[model samples]
Target: MDHDHTLFHRDDVVALRHDLALSLRAAAHHGLGEGICNHFSVMLGGNSGLFLINPHGLHWAEVGPDDIVLVDERGERVAGAHGVERTAMFIHAAVHKLAGKTCVLHTHMPHATALTVTPSGKLNTKLSQNAMRFHRRVAFDADYNGLAFDETEGERIAAALQGADVAFLANHGVVVCGESLAAAYDDLYYLERACQLEVLARSMGGGLAEVSDQVAEATAAQFARDRDQSRLFFEALRRELPLP
Candidate 1:
């Protein structure tokens, strides 16, 4: 929470914008994006109460430094473009109000969202090692009240996600947030991979042999103690982008 409270260097904004675009393109290439519908954001300028996201209507691959939209905590557009997506505003604005997390990434990635819509969409820790990484760490929002078009909806989502790094909205999709942009992207990537593995395993009709709660907990502990794992994963992915 409150990552910083000082003036953000101009170069900070420049790097934030560039890295954000790279992440968007990476998401697109990996088929983790919908038809310009998902949202990703990073806070801009320390203590400036400002954040940046791609403007509505731009495909993830098309997002660039100039196309990034700046918005206040209230979700009003302050820079880059005229309008912000209503649901994007609703969810992101509410989340950024909290501390600790800086970058928030929400997606309709098929693998993960497919699980969300199923009766057992919640990630089961016993499902796989990746699943174990989220053991007892996921917030499941069992209710889906249509689209998040207002602040009230945003507040609800934020409340459901409290104290957790990831939120799996039943019948909706997933939300991943992290203290840094790389961590956020890395988590999103792993989340989708975990879901894909689970779904495929289930498709084999083996009835999902999940690990015991004890083992799952141990795996989660191991993941939490993992130093720089997410950073390394994200950096490797970033190198494949047009530029860092």
Candidate 2:
């Protein structure tokens, strides 16, 4: 374990790690993690060549800035003190390679996973903040073979995510990727919240009704405008995590 600081000292990786750790912990705290599985990563520099990811088998709530493993664009461990998670490298590595996204957050939460098990994979949007974010940023991947280990499966998942900021992995979970960790985490958090609400609404036997299109559009615009404020949420989560 070469725990060298030089590899992660770059402003880009540091900011990414800090923000990602925060988001990971938040996801775990909100019930998005399955013990030690699930993973998150963000690209380094401009090439998406050296991304930051968590070491395998670590609880999401227990991860910190120093716990990240730096992996090259092809999923090979490039730096840092620990090794990469096999599944994470296989899935996220392929995504950054083919999709060219900077931030990728994958998790398995209860409500969202339930939605994926169905054929429709539809999330009822009934005017709540949860529904508003799901208006258009979400995508549903109906096919689930198994854990992503090959480039082709990862590419297929990425294809399902095309034009979608947040995607539901059929019979598995959800994946959200964005330009930054804050943006990605914000989307992930809201997606889970929305799913939880939808589950609750459906259990009552009354089908949910969506807010008018005009209202939905307006609320989504407001969420877009408040993107800057999402930074504060991430910051607060950072303060609560197990810092290094």
Candidate 3:
């Protein structure tokens, strides 16, 4: 059964489910996933009012697209035979509500999570590709206000993400949203890598060097030129896990 569309089709929903499962499993295999606390979602159909999110309390490796629950704009479960996470509803719902039908990935991956706890938490661009991809797309949340369980907190986060596509939830984790799951996953993957490198470099105690603004911008622009890069990255990651 197909749903109304403004930009995506039924196949797109299928593709999103497969990708989320693959991405989740890969994250689990790489020790990025933390039990069953994270959530990954992609917008389905053209209305920009609904999304597919992982079922609450399910491990990333076990989640399938078919297992993904469809949620409408108001955090209401609309499809699938599963329930959504409460925090996922508050956070992802608010994100989609403001960003419009977009894929949103939230996780408590190691390095990124570690960095979020620091007083001056930031995604230091010391790692080349990590630096390149994250350049200006990151938004840092300075306060860890516990689990997001209300529209107000969600709205605060949406406002924090004003012009960026990624956010580091202080004392919590990271959030990456995009026009597609491929793009969002690509960002989330590299974001963790970048955070890892930054933490490592800081441990060396010699400070870090940043790429010039011109160079960073040029690199990001080059990546943007290849719209298929996101999908390509996802495909490469799939080869590692190969299943949900």
The candidate that achieves the highest lDDT relative to the unseen native structure: 1
Clashes (candidate 1): 3
Every model's Cα RMSD, please? 3.4, 2.8, 3.2
Residue clash pairs of candidate 3: 5-46, 6-46, 7-46
Give lDDT tens digits, candidate 2, residues 184-223. Answer: 8878887778888888877899967777887887888888
Kindly report which residue stretches of model 1 are placed more than 4 angstroms away from their true locations once superposed.
Answer: 1-9, 98-100
| TM-score to true structure, per model | 0.90, 0.91, 0.88
Where model 2 places Cα greater than 4 Å from the true spot, the runs are 1-5
Report backbone clashes per prediction: 3, 0, 3
**Local distance difference test, each candidate:** 0.81, 0.78, 0.76
Which of 1 and 3 is ahead in lDDT?
1
For candidate 3, give the lDDT: 0.76
- Write one digit per residue (lDDT tens) for candidate 1, span 1-244: 2333232235777778777888898899899999979899887645677888877898888777767777778776666644678789788877878534588899988888988988876777788898888888788888889898767776777888878989898888999988888888888998999999988987898777878999999988998898499888778877877752
